[model samples]
Each structure stands twice: as structure tokens, then as C-alpha cells.
Target: MTAEQINDKIELCESAMDLILSEGSFTIAQLSEATGKTASQIYSLFPNKKAITEYYYPSLVIRYSAMIGEIEDFESYTISEKLSNFIFTTFDMMEDRREFVEDTFEKMVFKKGCNSEFHQEMTALFKHFFTTDGRIAVSAGFVMKDYFYEFIAREYLDIVKFWLNDDSDGKERSFALTDKLTGFVEEVVYNKVIDKGFDLAKYLISHAGLAKNIPLFGEWITSWFNDNEEENKDE
Candidate 1:
């Protein structure tokens, strides 16, 4: 969608969320009134209440992207800092709509599974800042080849779950949780931890002789190991 269309949808979603919170249910007419837009206008963006909520978390990602996109120096942030900005800004975005999130949590997560889209999109956004992995993928290999970003997306949802339960003052503990986790992950992933894990996995797989049984995943692992070694040789 064009940026304008996305923004209109986001506004409509915001109206739906507020209406849901205050009135305990949402309808197209209600959203139209809330947004000061006609029912047809609202329909054009969000056909139904479910679509609005479905777009909620993903919209937050876009909001973060837009927010950071404004900062003149955001591109200069370190990998960890970029991650921190993303996570912290997301929390801030949800803080005002915490009730909407709490009420819709099970529906959005358990039902629709937002992580598949949210984190993958966020990973693509991070692609702009996490240039090391991108560069490696171009020359050496795909450092985060397959399910790597998917795993990060899962981890992010786990963290969001943790944040929701956080009762500390302004969620100070959870913010600290984000900071510590991202710092550690950046140091590890950007520091060849994946390659190290590959070496260990290759050793284990060799000793176990899984080469005869499991073909797909085992070969994926072996292929990445081989590719990384080839890149090192070139270096």
C-alpha cells in the first residue's frame, strides 16, 4: 500500500481501538463517527473490525519506521541502539492503547499469529541498520539465512508477553530487560555466535552420523557451514 493509504488505515485502526475501549464494541458507523470520516471512507481502509485489529501491531511497526525515519541521526545508531529504539518506541506506542492490546491479545496473537508478519517486517526494517549481516549475505553468505529472523520475531513476541505482565513503575524492569537482551544479542549474533553454533552443530551431527538420516535440515546446516568457511578463505 502507498504510505498515504497506510496512514489512513492506521488512523481508522486507532479510532476502532478507542471505540472498542470506551464503548466495549466496534462498528463501522461508530468508527466513522469517531474518525470523523464517512462509513464508506472507513470501509475503504478497514472492511471490518477484525481487519482493524489485525493491522494494529503491524501498524505499530510502520509507526516506528516512520518515527525513526524522521530522526536525522537514526541511521547512525549502533545495532543495539537501533534495536532499543525499535522496541522502546513500540512500547511507547502501545502504552496509550494498552487496554486495547490486553483485550485483544489472545485474538491477535493466539488467533491470527501476528509474529509471522510483524517481526519479519521489523527485520526488514532492521535490515536498513543491521548492515553487517546484509553485507555478509551479499559477499560471504546469508548470515541470517533462513529462520534466523523468524526466530528473532518469536523472541520479540516472547519479550512483548513479558512486558505486558510487567507491573513495575513505568515498566522500568521491562525496559531494562529489552536493553540487556538486545545488548547481549547484538554482541553475540554480530560477533560470529551463529558460526560458532554451526561448528558445534557440525561436530555433533558428524559424531551422531545424522548425515544418513536427516537430509533437509542437516544439509542446510552443512551448506551454511561450508559457505561461511569458503567466505573465510576468501577473506
Candidate 2:
């Protein structure tokens, strides 16, 4: 599409999003009436209400990224602080559209093939912070980096869901919860890479209840020991 076409599509989607917020729902005909555009024109851009709702995800991500990117000291903030800022900024942006978000979340989030794009967008956002000082890179290499990103993406959505239902004073509880979760992830990665005092694999196995259900657990443990014995012989 040409630049002008792209701009028009964005404007239409923004208008539709506003309508969704104001009315708690919207149809293409309503959007056409509101925007002075034909129903066919709106349909050409978004085939259904769900598509318009899904448009908010990428649009909001871009807006949030640009907003945070403009902060002069954003890069200087620690990972947890950056995360807190992201969560707060996102909530601020969505404050006016809370109902629309909650209504469309089930329809858009975790759908078979829909989440991966959003996940990638979030991963790219977090990777900027994670790679700032090469902290995440220390423990997360080629094999583990994708998993780390996926975990952060999934946790971010989970936290947003929790935040929507939070009713504590000034929503301070959500901020505190986000801080704890980010801190825990940092500590786990730090111990896994820097301290090495805790064995994450062993901890996972121990906490994985119903050993019989996980047939690979025994084979994994045996292989771990065999590898250790081989290393000992090499030493």
C-alpha cells in the first residue's frame, strides 16, 4: 500500500477504536456512519470487529514504545524500573479504553495463531532492556533466548489481565506485583548464570509434582548424572 493508504487505514482504525471505547462495542456500519465512510470502505480495511480490536495491540505497542523512548532517562533506568514504567505507561494509555480491552482480550489473546505476533512485539520491547548491559545474554544464548522472550511475553499478558481486575489503592498492588515478578526473574537468571549456587534444573524437577506423569524426568536425571561422571573423568 502507498503511504497515503496506510495513513488512512490507521486513522480509520483509530476512529473505530474510539467508537468501541465509547459504545462498548461497534459494527462496521456504525463506524461508516461515524466516519462518513461507506460500510464497504471500512470493511475493506477491517473485515470484522475483532480485526479492529486486534489493531489496538500493535498500535498501542508502537505508541507506548515511542512514548517511553522519548524519556531522556529511560535508558538509565534498571530493568525493574523500566518494567514498572512500561506497565504504568501502558495502563495510562488504556485507562480510557479499559472496557474495550477486557471485552476483546478473550477473543484476541491466546488465540491459536494470533498471539505470536504480539509476543514478538513484546519480546522486541523487552530485549532492548535485556540486552542493554548484556545481562540476559549471559545466561540466555541461542538455545534459550527464544524461551526467555516467550516467558516474558506470556507473563506480561498475565500481569495485564491481573491488573485489569486489581482494585487496591491507586492500583499500587499491580505495580508491586510487577516489581516482584520482574525481580524474581532477574534473581533466577542471575543465579543461573552468575552465582551458579542454585541448580535450576534440580529445583524444577523437585517441584514438578507427580513424577510418574513426567516420563522424561528419570531419563533426564540419569543423563545429567552420566554427563557429570564423564566430566569428572575428563577432569
Per-candidate Cα lDDT values, in order, are 0.72, 0.69
lDDT per residue for candidate 1 within 1-235, as digits (tens), equals 7888888998988877788778888888777777788877777886677888778888888888778758887666776787888888888888898898776666676444434456567667765556544323232135554455555666677778889999999899998988898897677555655556776657856787664366687677767767877977986
lDDT of 2 by residue, 53-117 (tens): 67777666666786875899777776777777877788886777777777766557645322555
Superposition TM-score, candidate 2 onto the true structure:
0.68
In the order shown, the candidates' Cα RMSDs to the true structure are 8.2, 9.3
